[model samples]
Each structure stands twice: as C-alpha cells, then as structure tokens.
Target: MSTAVTAGASGAPRRVPATVHRRRWAILGVLIFALLVVVLDNSILNVAMKTIASPAPIGLGASQSDLEWAINSYTLVFAGLLFTSGLLGDRLGRKKVLLAGMVVFGGGSLLSAVAGSPGQLITFRAVMGLGGALVMPATLAIIMNVFERDEQPKAIGVWAGAVGLAIAIGPITGGLLLQHFWWGSVFLVNLPIVLVALVGMVLLIPDSRDPNPGRLDPVGVLLSVIGLVLLIYGIIKGGQLADFTDPAAWGTVAGGLAVLAAFVLYERRAEHPALDVTWFRNPRFSASVAVIGLVFFALMGVTFFGAFYLQSVRGYSALKAGALLLPLAVAQMAFAPRARLVVDRYGVRATCAGGMALVALAFLGYLTLDTTTPIWVLEVIGFVMGTGMAHVMPPVTVTIMSALPREKAGSGSAINNTFRQVGGSLGVAVLGAMLSAAYRNGMSDHLSAVPPALRGPAGESIEATLGVARQLGPRGAALVDPAKESFVHAMHIVAGTSAGVILLGAVVALVLFPGRLPVPDAVGAQPEAEPEAAPAETA
Candidate 1:
C-alpha cells in the first residue's frame, strides 16, 4: 500500500500516513539510542579526567588547558559543522548520513581509546564531533519526519528525556569503568552501543530527505566554520593566558565576529541560503534559542568545575563523585514529564522564565559551599538545578521546532543545537578561564611563604599543588589546607557569576518570548517569500 499525506482545508489538521503512524515509536527508539551515545560521550570524560591526567601507565600529565581542550574540542567542531552537516543530510539521504556518522564516530572512539597523548585524544574527539554533527540533527529531523503534529510534543518529550538520561548516566558509567578498568574504557565502551544502534537504525528506519534540496553554500560554510573556531579559540586562549588584553585573544575574537557578520549578510542575499537568516525574526524562536544557550552555558560551566571540586578539593573518589551526581539525574527525570504539562498549562514564557529563576536560586545556594559543607547540601543543590533545567529544555526545544516548516526541521534542529553547543563551549572556556585566573592569584598569595622552587608548579593547578604538598612530607601539610581554601574561593566566584548570567537569561526570556506561541500554520505549509529588506534580529 502506498502511504500518503492528506492535505487539509485552511486551519485544519493534516492526516499522517498510516505507514508512518505505525512505525513511529520504533523509529523513535533508534533515534534515541543514537542520541544517547552522542550526548553520553560529551560528559563521560569528566569523571575520568583524573585517571587520564595522572602520572603513570596512562599518564598524559595534562594541564588544565589540555583537559579543557579534551572536552571542548568535540563541542567546537560539532558546533562549527552542524549547519553544513544538516544541509548534506537534507540533500543526500538522512539515514545514509546517519549510518555513515555512526561508523565515523565508532572509528574515532577506537582511536581515542588507544590515544597516548592529550593532543591525540583531543584530535580524535574532534573526529567524533564531526560524526556527531551528522547524528544530532538527523535524530530530530527523523522524528519530525516520522511523527504527526499531535504526536510531536510527546515524541519530542521522549527525545528530550533521553538527553537528560544520558547526562545522568554518563558520569556513573565513567566512574564504574574507571573503578574497575582503565580510563580508555570510557571511549571503548561506545563501541558496543554504537554497534547496536547501527544495526537497529539500518533495519528499522527508512531514508528521508528534502524533496527540493537546494544548492550547497560553500562560502557560507567556510565563513561559519572559520568564524566559530577562531571565536572559541580566542576564548580558550584568553583563559589559559589569563589576559583579556592579549592581541591574539581579543583580536581573533573581533575577527571571528566580523566574519560571522559577513556570513549573515551574505546568507540574506544568497538564493539558496545555507541557513535561513530570517528565522531570528520570530521572537519565540530567537528567545527559545537564547534561553537554551544560557541554560547550557550555566550547566556546562558548573559541571566542569563541580567535578573537580568534588574530587580534588573534597577528596571524593571518582566513583563517589559520580554516584553523588545521581540525585541530579533523579530530579531531572522526576521533573521532565511535569515540565511538558506546565508548558501546556502555563505557556513557554512563564515555564521557561520560572525554570531559569530556579536554576539561578540553585546557583546562589552553591555560593555557600566550602570544604566543610555537608555532602547532603551539595545533593540538594544539584537536585534543585536539575529540576529547573528539566523545566527549561523541553518547551524551549519544542518552541524552536514548532516555528519552522516540517521540511526545514533538519536545518532548524541544527541551528538550535549549534547555539547550544556554542554556549556549552563558551561556558567551559569562559568559566574555566575565570576559575584558573582566580585560583592562580589566590594560590600565589597563599603559597608566597613556600620555597620559591615549589611556588611555580603549585600555582599551575589544584592537582599540581596537592601533588607538590604530597612530595614535601610534613612541610607539605601546610600547603594542603591553603590550596583547598583557594580552590573553594574560586568556586564561589564562579557560582555567583553563573547565577547572575542565568538571571539575565531569565529576564530576556520573560521580556522577549510572547505570553504564548503564535498558532502555527499547517505542517509542511510553504514558508512565505523572504522580504528583501528584513532587518536581522540579534540572537
């Protein structure tokens, strides 16, 4: 039987083909499995950093900068290529692209597992990211393709829940693997999962693509990739050097932004634009993007530091720290379903803003953290932040997708995720930089009385400081408490700053997002022709 979409009268709902309706849930499972592996890879490394950087068999002796790159390199490459990857999937076959991505990602994981140096690991991570760019957008785009409008919210809810589940499980999985096996086991573990997903995807999912896929935009691709990489490079460099005024830092940032501006202008004029520049004109879409970006900015920034705080300062083992983070996952899972209901009853503006406010309050709560603070208090704070994040992400993602025509879902999903990846990258870059600078200054003052020979390495990082203290025997005991204290002080500053930024995002959501989303036109409705002189809205 040939499946078909039945067109509706004006304002009426379109009928989904019977073929699609029957297989939708099965397709969703494959998509979620793929998404889980990609999202899980993003955080699993956090728990294993200690092992990777430790001095021994797998010793890389990675500096703070090297560690940050090990994490951000994947994100930076993922963000830069998302739009282009989406375009290719739309023009080529989505399933083919997805299968190919899985292969590449699996290969990257294999290489990463055997990596001997920080640089090799970082490079392989970027390779995984290239594959991720294909997988991420294709998952959502496939969901949009296979499901009807009425089913979309629920399906998207499931998709969003899978992401939260990945975040929750990633650390625990890494911690367990690190406890019994080597740090390389984290990357190695992806192989079996990828194999299962690949088999399922090939057997269950059908290929789909844009019927009228347009010309490839080479210049636009070049500008976006270059601009984003340079911008992120500058941010990471600034943090490492701890100098905002360095020409290499600020200058590259300025140049990157300028190139991006040119790309936007060119996109408006191009007949077959890689990204529809006018999507920002819709306030609901733009505000939702901003809110998601800011939420991740805070989430990633805190997660990066929090892992270190638990292990390095509080002296929790990797397994314990990962176990402690389970409360966050539990809270998020508890709240995710309710968040959808809240959006239905209260509207996105209220739900999103309220969620942001909760996250800000959580951050404020962390301001009191110290070496002596109870473990239960940290759990409470994680729960509060996780619940708030649960509220924010789902509705915001749905809103962004709802604003676009179903045919444009791949590109739209890519754009939405691109901002998210960019925000997370920046979060780690900016917050990591701040923590590094503050720790250096605080430790410099605290360790001034120590022997000059010990000052330099001790000031390099919290791990280095503790390592130095361990070497000095009884004399090193004096440096241990002060180093931990300095680290806590830096953490306090990061939490406070993150709170303010999240609050600002909440205000933006409240002010910019409409009280309710405008009623969307029929699914697959042709977008109106772009106006020649439409003013670009700032994102």
Candidate 2:
C-alpha cells in the first residue's frame, strides 16, 4: 500500500498509489504522538528543577547558574544540530532516522532518570537534546512527505495542536509527579511514551526518501553547527557571564554570524549543500521560520519565568502554579486546531502576523504585572497570549512544510525548529540572568537596613532575596516577611523585560513576513530532501 511519486505534467512531484492518501490521516497521528513526546520533555522538567537542585537528589550543590544550564544544555545541542539532523533524515530515510531518534531519546531519558549528580543529569540531557534534534524535524518532514498539498494545512494544524497540548499539560503533569515522587520521575515519564512511539513507528510508519538526493556538504554542516552554538551561547551569556559590551560576548556573536554567513556562501557554491540558502530568497520560507522563532522565544520566556514568578515570588506552591496555568493551555487547545481553517480562508500572512501582534499585546499586559497584581489580570494575559500562539503556529508550520520539495522537508523542519530551540534557550538564560542581577542588587540594598547581628544564615535556599528573609527568622524576618517590597520590584523588572522581548518579536514578524504568501507553484517544486520539525513555535 506504499506510494510512488513522480513529477507531474507541470514538473512538480505528486504522490502515486492513491491509496496512500487514505492512510495519511493515520500516519499523521503517529507523527503527532512522536511530536508530543518531544514537546512535553522540553518543559516538563521545570516543575522539578528546584528538587533537582537539592543536595539529597543530586548532591551537586547546584546554583542559579547551574539551574539555567540544566535547562539550556539540552536546548543548546538541540538547536545547534537540528538543521544537520534534518538533512541527514532527508538524505537517508525518514522512518529509519525517526525511529533511531526515538530510541536515542528514550535512552537519554533513562540515563537522566538515574543520574546521581547535576553534571550527570546535564550530560544526559544533552544526549536527549541530540535525540530531540532528530525527532522534531523528522515528525514534520514525515507529515509533509505523507500528506497531499491540500490536506497538509489541516494535518499541520493537528500537529500544532498536539504540540500545544504537550506544552500546556507538561507543567501540571510535572508538578503532580514532583509533588508525589522524586525529581527523577520527570525524566522517567518520557520512557513509556517513547516505547509506545517506538513500537507504533516501527509497525505503522513508512519509509520515504528524496528522489534526487544531493551529496552531503560536510563544510556546510560544520559551519552551521558551530555558528549556531556560538550565537546561542553569546545570547544566553550576554547579560550574565558578561554584558553585551564585553568583547568576548560581542565577539562570539559577531563570529557566529560570520560563520553563518560563510556557511551560506559555501552552500550556494557546493554541488550538494546541506541547506539550500536559496530558501531564504523566498520570503515565504524565511518569514515562516523567523516568526516561529520569535513566538517560541516569547512563549518559552513567559512559561519558564511565569512559573518561577508564581511559585517563588508569589509564594504559591508548585502544584498551585501548575493549576493556575491550566487555563492558558486550555486556550491554546481550543484555538490551535481551528487555525488551519482560519489560515486556509485568510492566508498565512494574516494568521501569523495577527498572532504575533496578539502576543505583543499580551506582553504589554505582562509589562504591568506585579506581586500584588490581580490573578484575573494574569489569566487574561495568558489567555490572549495562548490565542495568539494558536493563530500563528499552524499556518507557519503548513507554509514552511508545504513550500519545500518532498526531499528537503527534513532540513526545512530542522532549521525552523533549531531556531526555536535556540530562541527558547536564549530566552531563559537571558531573562534568568536579568532576574538574578535585579534580585541581588535589590537584596543587597534592602538588607542594608537590617541589623548586622541578624544577617546570619537561617538555613534556607540562597538563590535570591528570599534567601535573606529565610535566614533572618521571625524577629529578623520582619523586614521582609510581610512584604519584600524590593524583591517584588525585581520580579516585576524581570516580567517587564520579558514583555519587551515579546513585543520585539512582533516587530520582527511584521517586518520579515510578506503581506501574503505566494501561490504554491511560483516557488520551484523540484522533489528535494526534507528536514525535521524542530521549529520553536511548533513545540
């Protein structure tokens, strides 16, 4: 029941064996499950990060910086190799690569679950990220390879919905597990799902490859990987390890961009390039990836920091914060499936651009948030942000996946997803750094008013100003107990900064995306290699 595709009278390849079309829906389901596993893993660990930092769990004596690294390490590798992984899948077979990716991911999860130290966990997480780089891109590429042009928008919409569901549910799921079990439980959860996906994929997924596979460009892969790593590292470290003014920070940023430029130049000349730089020449593909990155950058920032603000700042427990976020996820679930119809009727430009604008508006709401802000306000902001994401994610996904030739879908998915992982990592690192600085500065000032005798350690976590209050006890804690005004101000600063970043994404999306995507055939439809579904927004 497999299909063979050949170029049509118009020279665009079309799938044969019409029966394959009938199974498209089923194949899409398998890929969607695979996608859900990766997306859930991306954020599920956050609820348990504090426990992981505890000495009883890992005994690594973790710090704020280490916590940030624990999250970013996976994303760093995921973003760095995503594009190349997609190219490999396209040149190879989608099912073969996807199945292999699932095994690797499952193994990494097992390793992370059993890890005894922060270093071990971080290392295993990186391995998981490597697996993720492959899995994310392959999922999208497989969907593009299996489904027809007309059916693609709807399939992609479902895919986006699955991803959104994972994200929305990850926090509560992680919180519940953490509340009842060990920090390792979070990683262990990945095992059963991976096993299910593995068995299903082997039994149900079909093998697909590029009809005109190109030679692998080793130089292009090297440049792209190294360049992306450097760029992400620079952005993450900009405000923390060194300010943006630091030569090392700016140097890494400059060098990374230069390497990327060189990679693009090499790609243009290579007999068979890993990436088709020509894709950027098409505003449709370029804009799709850019908007995907922007949305995820902001989305990740809100979720990651919002979780911290709710639990650490507002004094809510992990389970409570997860419960509060339920509505935001509900909003995304409600809207994401419908995005396809909206896009199909209104076009990608309106859907994507409008989504970005909504996110920006939500961020504006976030800018005004504080410890005393009404809960309803945060809910409203969350709902608006979720709706905006629902609008943008599916259409951009369909646009990017459908625009490429069948063979090139892997690389395309990889590049888009890599940018997103990079953006998410940078968001956490960058915003985390900002929050850390403000906390320390404000803590130091507020403590200056305390008696020197009351400044002794009180056996509490010392990551931020909360450390001082916890150390001072009831009599000494009076200074900060009822209301840690300065600490509240610092948290407010972090939220405001994150909001500004989201608004910036809106500007970038509006500027880069053309008013309308061109008709399908206008872009060359030569059968080409595909990439993976590692884009940030899709996650």
Candidate 3:
C-alpha cells in the first residue's frame, strides 16, 4: 500500500504518490477509535458511579458530589488546558503530542481502575484530564491539517457523530460491564483500546506542526488553569450559600472571581498567550462561543440531573436509564449531518437561533413533568432537545475554527471547549443544588416523625437514609417513599429553571448570530488580520 508517513517527531518522510497515501485512512480509523475510548470514558463513568462506589477495594461510597467530580474534574482540566494544548501541538508535533497524551490517559485509567479510595480516584481523574487536554485538540488539529476545508464540516460532523455514538452507547456499555464485573472494569476497558491506538499511531499517523510556532506562555497556562478551577469551585459552592453571608462558601466565590479576572489581564499581556483574547472583539466569534457554551451547559445539566432522577427517584435501574437516554443520542446523531446543510443554506444566525428556540420549547415541555410523567413524553422532549443541540454545536465549531488562522486552530478548539466546560460545570452545580434544596425543603413535612433535629439533616441526605431503609425491608422502605416524592417535586422546580435559562439563551442567539454563515474566501481559511506579533510580556 502507498503511504505518506513521518518517521519521527521532527523529520519529514520521503514523498509518496497520492495513490499510495490513500490507504493511510487506517490511521484515521485508529484515531477515531481512540477518540471513542476517551469520549466513552466520560459518560460511562457517570452511569457506573454508584456501582463503582459500592463495596469494593475502592471503599468509596459514591455520593452525588463524588459522581459530579468523577465527570467534572476530567472535563474541568481538559477544558482549562484546551487553548494551551493546541499551541503545544503546534510547537511539539501532532504525533508526538498524541502519543504522550495516550500514555498519560492510559496510565490514568490504570490508576483509576485500582484506586482504593474516592480521593485516589479524584487524583487519578485529574491525571486523565491532563492527558485528555492533549489528545482531543491534537486529534482535531491533525484532521484539519489532513483534509481540505471543503471536507472539514463533513469530516468533523462524522467525528462528532462518533462522539455522539460514544455518548449513546457508554451507559449501555457501562451497564453491561458493571453487570459482568466490578466498577473498576469500566476503567480497565481502556487499556486494550489505547494499546491498539498507540500501535496504530506509529504505523499510520504522521508527525506535523505549525511552520511558525511562537514561544510558550507558562504564566498564561497557570492562570487559565487556576482561573477555571476557582470559577467552577465558586459556582458549585453557590448552591450551598445560606444568604450569601457564609464566608466559607462565599470566600470560594470571591477568590475564584479574582483568579479569573487576573487570568484575563495576564492573557492580554502575555507573549504567546494561551488564549487569544482578540477573538472576542469579533461579534461572531463571541456570540458563537457563548451559544456553544449555553447549549452544552443545558445539555450537561439534563444529563447529570436526569441520570440521578431516573435511578434515585423514577425507580429505573442503571440499565434502563441508559436505555432511556438512547433516543436523545439518536436524535443528536441523526440531526448533526443535516445541521451543516442547514448552516450552509440558512446561515449560522438563523440555524443557531432557531435551534435555541426549539431547545427552549423543549424546556417549556419539561415544565409539565411530574413523578408520573410517561416515558414517551420524556422521549419526545429528548428528541427535540437533542436535535436542537446537535444543530448548534457543529455549526458554531465550524464558524469559530474557520474564522481563525491555521496556527490558531488548536487554541481555538481549546477555548471553545473551555467555555463549554465552564457552562456545563455551572449547569450541574446550579441545577443540582436547586434540586437538592427544593427536595430538602419539600421533604421537611414528610420527615416530621424522624425527630425535629434529624429531620433537617435527613432531608439533605435522603439517599443515605434510603439505603438504610432498603436494608430494613418493606415498612422502612415505605416510610422513605414520601421523601422520595418530595425530592421528585424538587426536581420539577430544577427543570423549570433550566427551561428558563435555555429560553434566554435562545433569545440571545437569535439576536446575536448573523442571518447566515459567513462566506469566507475559502473554507477553513484564516481571516485577514495585521501581521503576526509576538505575545506581549506579562508582569
């Protein structure tokens, strides 16, 4: 087979005819497979949290907060480092970066599989996040280097579809794995897939980098990382706020803001800055990025809350909850390809705004949900929301990537992901806290017999009590059902708030997005701007 390949990190290979290189799609296949593992890891772990936390060598009694960190920690670091990861790729070389990421990720998964405590798992998860930061942006940046711009939207659509497939199947796969083995088996699953990807990388993928890479900005990198962590910490703590006077929680809030503000100031001055703050000057760039963030924020909120509601309140097991989310994934998969076409003909403004409107409508539909709501009704809402979200993500991604020069794609992808992660973190924390508060408040009357002092703490920790009730048999379980009902009612309030936020996002998109996608000189072509200047020095 004819092949085009780079032998090492810095060397160029002998030129091969186009005919020979056509067979090299095997490399792309491997990349896709590896991507599947990482994406699947994100969703699968969430589904298996309770199972993993069960009695085991890990000794982790998985709480909802543990579940949140298992998912969010990886995403937080991944999002935080995305901008810098891309720049790193440009300077370091794609294949080398990709391999390093794989090694770190695989090692992290191994650590996670054997973790003996919740704290250990959290630490390892951060390690995985660091690796993921490298892998994701490199994968996309490599694709951009290989494919023509005209081919980009379709390729990325298929790429996103693969990620969607992972989302669709992860819970099911996780359910099956948990059924057959311990929770650690979920992390164990990565080793074989990653091994195959690593082998394929040496054989099929080539090394590449930007022709003119700038200096690295360590200060900018630290600022971005600390800033994101602080912001998310503050937002998550917002739910625990008792009249904004609680210094412990509110201090997290204030410190996080200070860090983020400092990050912005550093970015503006840093030479070879991690984030290109100039992009926000363009209305299109800022609006598209915000739209991307809001859509995913709402999406993650639904997934995070819905998973808990399905099992804890709706009485569905892990397998059934995964099955229920399948339709939403199907809707997303089906609509994603068509989204590009819609963007092509209608323009980004109309497609994004219209999609947001549909999401709002879906949220409005969620307002009717109660404890007895039919499965089919929920499925319909999933279908609508999925389609709307599918339409939003790819177009915004294409618009943002296409707007930037080639060298900036990695950083651009990182920025896009950062906003997405931030929004998602906020969504889960805010929506979840609301649900927790409402559930607690509503359950106060139901817990009257539990002793007035215990009642408050009991409401705050219904699941722990429910676990105890399950061991005590029918009478105990019966007593707890009323509290469960209260929690469900609280969830309804959360759904109402999420719907409102989504509606606001739709309106904002409609107002800000252009009537159509911009027709550039060429697809994926960089915008005309002043000469490339070195990053300014930071204090």
Question: Residues 1-539, candidate 2, lDDT per residue (tens digit)?
Answer: 22344444445555533444446787787787788888888668877777777787443466667777777788778888888888878778878889988999999999988887778888999999888888998898888877756566777777877877887678788888887878888999999999888888886677776757766678889999999988887776684563677877788888889999998889899988887788887767777777677667666765656775677657787777777776667777788878877776776676777787787788677666766788888889888888888888887887777667777788778877887777776666566666556655555544555566544322111234355565556744655542344445655675666666666656665676655555446244445333222122221
**Model 2 accuracy (lDDT, Cα):** 0.73
Candidate 3 lDDT over residue span 132-205, tens digit each: 88898878766655544555576677667677778878888889998888888889898999999999887777
Best by lDDT: 1
Ranking by lDDT: 1, 2, 3
True-structure RMSD, every candidate: 5.9, 5.5, 6.9
Candidate 1 lDDT: 0.81
Give stretches of model 3 more than 4 Å off. Answer: 1-28, 57-73, 237-245, 452-454, 468-481, 522-524, 527-539
Clash count of each predicted structure? 0, 20, 8
TM-score of every prediction relative to native: 0.92, 0.87, 0.87
| lDDT winner between candidates 2 and 3 | 2
Report lDDT (Cα) of residue 430, candidate 2.
65
- Top-TM-score structure, candidate number: 1
lDDT of 1 by residue, 83-191 (tens): 7888777778678888988999999999999998899999999999999988999898788777665557678877877787898789889988887888899999999
Error of 2 at 476 (Å): 4.5
